[model samples]
Target: MEIQLKLYGSSKILSEKETLDIQLPNNSDIKKLRDILTKIISEKYSRSDLENLPKTAAFFSEKDEVIDDSYKLSNKEYISIIPPIGGG
Candidate 1:
């Protein structure tokens, strides 16, 4: 199945895209998706960098409502990620 993914803020700098097409299993949970993204991010940057990031450093959603990190996802579902913003 294909999922729609969106990366925002600093994550965009690392990911280099506002959105992407993620192909996964039929029904993958957030944990699995997270694992996949972690691998993807690690490929772009360092795994330590991604590990040091706060959970709130990024936001995940299946639709509009905020979903728990453990939430499961369906095929072709939209998953948007908003990395933490920085400012003075």
Candidate 2:
């Protein structure tokens, strides 16, 4: 199954488009997604720059709420990745 990853903040560097398509096994959860993300950054992107993204980022469902690691994902679901924000 594949899901659309909607990017935000530093996560925007993951792709040129607003969203990226990620393929995962059936019934995968957010924890699996995090692992996949970590692999993607390490393989396709700069590991030093994004090595912490998977651990520090927050995942949001289409309903605009944060989803936990155990949250089950459905095929073709749209998930938003929001990287950590910092300001004074």
How well does candidate 1 match the true structure in TM-score terms?
A: 0.70
lDDT of 2 by residue, 1-88 (tens): 9999999988889889999999999999999999999889888975587899999999999999999999999999999998998868
| Regions of model 1 farther than 4 Å from truth | 46-63, 86-88
Model 2 spans > 4 angstroms off: none
lDDT of 1 by residue, 1-88 (tens): 8888776665565555678777777778766776777776667676564553435554466545667666778887887766566779
RMSD each, Å: 2.9, 1.2
RMSD of candidate 2 to true structure, Å: 1.2
Candidate 2's TM-score: 0.94
Q: Which ten residues in a row have the lowest lDDT in candidate 1?
A: 49-58
Q: After superposition, how far is residue 6 of candidate 2 from its true place, in Å?
A: 0.4
Clashes of 1: 0
